[model samples]
Target: MLRSFSYVTDHTGFCGTIKNSASDFVVTEIEVPEHLLRDTRAESLQKTSEAQLEPSSLCLQQPKKQRTEPPSPCAEGCHGGAPSPSERDPSCAGGDCSASPNKKQPEGEPELRSGLEEASMLDSLLGKPMSELLNKFACDLKDAWDLENNADAATREFSLGPILDKKDRADLHSAVRQKFPFLVTVTKDNEMIVKGNADYRELCQLVTEKETSDFFKFLDAKIENSTFSFAPDGNKEHRKVVHHFINRKFGRLLETKSFTVTDVNDQPNMSIMVRFREKSWSRKRSAGGFQEKQDLYTDFSYTGIKDKKAITYQPMVVKKVTPERLKEIGSKMEKKGMRIHNIHSACQHLRLGQLKGNHFDIVVRDLKHHSHDSSADLKERISEAMENVETKGFVNYYGPQRFGQGQNVQTDQIGLALLNEKMVKAVKLFFTPEDTDDPVNNAKRYFLQTEDAKGTLVMLPEFKVREKMLLRALNRYGVNHEGCTKGWLNIPHSMRIFYIHAYCSKIWNEAASYRLKIYGSKVVEGDLVFSEENDESVSLNDKVHVVTAPEESANKYSIKQVVLPMVGHSIKYPSNKVGQWYHERLSKDELQMCKFRVSPLQLNIPGCYRPILKNVQNLSYFLEGSEKGIEIEDNHLNAPKVSLHVSFDLDPSCYATVCLREIMKCDF
Candidate 1:
């Protein structure tokens, strides 16, 4: 193969230098294609005698003339073995290549070369090119480096090969191991000690297309008393062990440095507050299939929407230490799996589950943008609605999200299927994975549908970790629907929790529906009432808590609390007709109130009560210019628009949507 490089005598021009100085020569990889450096090898080497290739005869002991220019006047007489002017061959013309025969008449004392000069001479001798003198020297310095004969030692280096998928971008991961061809040892010796892929050089090269050398500077990491602190980027997640994207240059220092975590608590909190205040650039589709430009701000507000107003945020207070390492930008596309999950966990948080519910501030803005009703009309409507709400109270409806929020919603159905031990249905529902973009997964799902557990397992990419796990259970026992059903146990505990929670939510919603239907808007006797004033000892398992008339004020009809049942093994139906109705419903399905005791899975969902009534406090709203907040810009309406600026506090787990439905009288 041909290489594009000149044999220049003076090579002092190389701005690009790899951070790793392990080897004297940095091999900027030449694209030696498969045709060039394949596993195919030449015939066995013809062994040579020790006389033909002596240790001193190799490139290490090449003539000084071959390594550098002839010595200067200060270097004169330094090479004692060098022939004098009188003894020098006549071909040594007087160009300082050799001194004239009798010209040096000075009686100076013996001089020795400085250490710097000696080292320079050695470097030049070892690394520089040699002029060919084939007459005496049998071979060039490059030719003597044959691994078959004179080569002695080997060195291996690690590098991130070109990664295509961002999610599978972690170095040394199983995917990386399987995909990238691991590079090992360059032949410097004949001893042929075969070291593995893990035996790698400590340092790496980082090159950028831009002029700024900012990335070249290593991170300023300080670990005092086991607390590691380093500046994390706004784009990347904070990392543990200081590896991955933050320049692995300091990785070796982690071993020698005093930051070795001895105790579990000493593990550093790598959680970084995601920069949600800033805008993220995204390519959005506009007209046709073309992608349009858009600056999407991070949704930091707790309202769970992508509107501009939601961009205002504070750092999320994380309770758990971040266990994920920062993904190296450009290493790979992080579009799926644990990498994306971790990124989402570290950055975009999903406001779900049982929120710590003392109080939650709800900001309902721009209601007027969508509301065409007049101010007085809206005010009268809201007043009447609130009065009605004060009397009847809000329905305890678990919004569309509980069932997976979109048109073909079915997660709740899947949850019920699992709860009922309809494992096949649950597996089928789950295997038809959401966000179907990858064809490979689609194919695997097809095989899974065919009940070819083994085939599907093989076809499923390693990245389809969840699917592989379920299929592995099937494979381990035997390929059958029953074994596959048993594989549901292998699914994530969080997922199992979700299924049970969804089932509980569904049951609760139905019971609430029945309650609403029977007693339309009145606090009846034997009804469980949730009251902040009622200092009652309520177990989370207590599905329904009965209450007597309050002594604070006998005639007061305010709904301080409206509690409903959550199905559990230890729970009981409410008293009177409501309790009878719950009994009838549970009896039909052969489901006991105590059937929710999923103790074996440790998902023992102790029933809890959700308030059937929630009071909105500090409620206020205004038309466009009438108030401070009126968010018209985000409302997509021009000026003179009516934008409701409302703020109120509701306990955690209460949906703002339900309250909005009462006020706006519209389904969003």
Candidate 2:
């Protein structure tokens, strides 16, 4: 349990549990579009698929020899041959007179009297609107197949105008598939296309050459569009097999979209599209002023997919980092169930505080309220509490994740030691193991007892990389004050900064609570308020002016306008009682209010200010409608129920857990 953070509202918060499961807490960074990293897998997969199925056969295969004679009307049921005019019967309707074709007729259907009669018959089977649509499509199909008028007849393609209704288009597509076996249908942007076997066979040839062209294909001819489209003819399972086969062979180069196609025998099929993604490049001027291709693909790569569990993503800008180094970093992160995706070159590096904020989806379970209350009563209470939070907002305290969790030494403890210039104590605090009797801890205990860095290194688990690094440093430098300080320096700058930041956060939290308790919601004298230039979106920097005294009262600063500093040498404390409180807290820690630097450590704490109260953005909640309990680990109850799902957005660095704490009034 953590310390009780003060709340702004007077509403009584209900008791509930959070994060019983990983899914209970969901967080996503709200990044800017310009800085959004691309996912290289999508492009890489496409290229691989295309490379595997490069359309070599399509280019190599001889063009079909021009047919000398006209194609037979047998496909249109003219098996007996064209009848003489004198002998032609109106009932024949340009089809066979002597016998019915091998094709299955619609049940209880008679021979067509004419094209109109056939359409009329279809009008009864499907709706009139659909019948008319198919009628037009049939005409287009006939025109494309007409070899007499069009020289490039086989290459011709036409769309069966927009079929907006999915069911209607599907039914019509199915009908056409059965009616015209040689023709193919592909729906794009609600418009259906009718093509011939010539195109399909060319694609099949490419697929046959590259057995596993999964997502993309390369073509010999220059394609103006990025994607190459195809339709696979089969039942659902057969289509699935074809799709899986292509994916396995091509390895994700092909981009696929679902479209319905029916086989000649009226079985359903899958529609597939392949997008060929090449590295985008720019034209650069050489010394001669002539344009040359400059490869920009090497500059930018993408990482991450739309995964709920893996919600937080950040873009990193590295200079002079080799592929091998990137691979090593990726491998290490992956070992910890994390990943670094798509390392590519970029024109510029990402800057900190460039994002708007964070989005959170939180679930609170196992509600405990007044015992006799009904479900509706409980819901009302929950809603009321949430309403207060939405309207009045909660105190903006940093969550426990900022500090170290469990029984291990809190990050602030080490930070305090560093602030007090007790470098040896800080170093010891870092290596000190908890009371828990775990194998990893036992290894740490062994190191403490024997002082054999090499032997302990062997016993240390592979996952404890930081500990291993420290031990290795000690092995080289020996275990002494100077050696340990050097070992601490070996740790990453970001991590070392984190420990100090945690201490600052601790002070910020305590100061904020006291401020709220003494002043309530009123804006008082000596309170630091942001100038107009400094808003929630802006980062705390020298540019942001801290308005105090005359300006604070004149500006009518609200509680939300008040700011607290994260104690640093550069940052100014609040001028009133809250400011005095910071001095007292630092005194208790055996540190001066002014000096925050250790010259030898080569570290400086350039702190920033944060708003004491934050208004929850787009706050909303709903009751989970389930009688069954959510299965959770380490639950003593027969069935621990999850009742509420809450969602909101907060400014960057503001903790969702703290907001929930204000709502639930329960320590996590």
Query: How much RMSD separates candidate 2 from the native structure?
Result: 24.1
* Per-residue lDDT of 631 in model 1: 49
For all predictions, the C-alpha RMSD in Å is 31.1, 24.1
Q: Find the number of clashing residue pairs for candidate 2.
A: 18
| lDDT tens digits, residue span 1-668, model 1 | 00111111111111111112222111111111322221111111100000000011112122212211221232222111133434543322211122222123121211111111222222111111110121012223223323345543233232222322222222112211111112121222221111222212121111110100111110110101111222211222223322453324222223221221112233332221111111211332111111233332333222122112121222221312222323343135334211222221321122221122222223333333233443333334434554555444455466545666542436766666665666666777767654566755565556656877787776767877777787777667654456756576666554666766676676676777677667644556667754342221222233235644462135234343556776654445667567787778766665644466443333444354666655655455443544566543432333333433344444444555555455544444
Regions of candidate 2 where Cα sits further than 4 Å from its true position: 35-352, 370-376, 534-555, 627-642
lDDT of candidate 2 vs native?
0.55
Candidate 2 per-residue lDDT over residues 1-668, each given as its tens digit: 24765788866666677776767777766664641322101111011000111110011123233222222222223222233444433332222232222222232122111221223223322333343455455455445444346656566566655654454455445444433333456778977776654433333443431211111112211122333333343345545665565455433233445565444445554445444334211322221111234232223222211223334555655533444466778877788766777654332233334345678887778776634433434555677889989998888887887676674888898888877767668877877788978877888788778777888789888989888887887888877877777666666544565677678888888998999889888888777775544222233344335555776568666887788887776567777898899889889888865466554453456555778888888998876534655442332222346467899987655678788888766677
Error of 1 at 484 (Å): 3.0
CA-lDDT, candidates in order: 0.36, 0.55
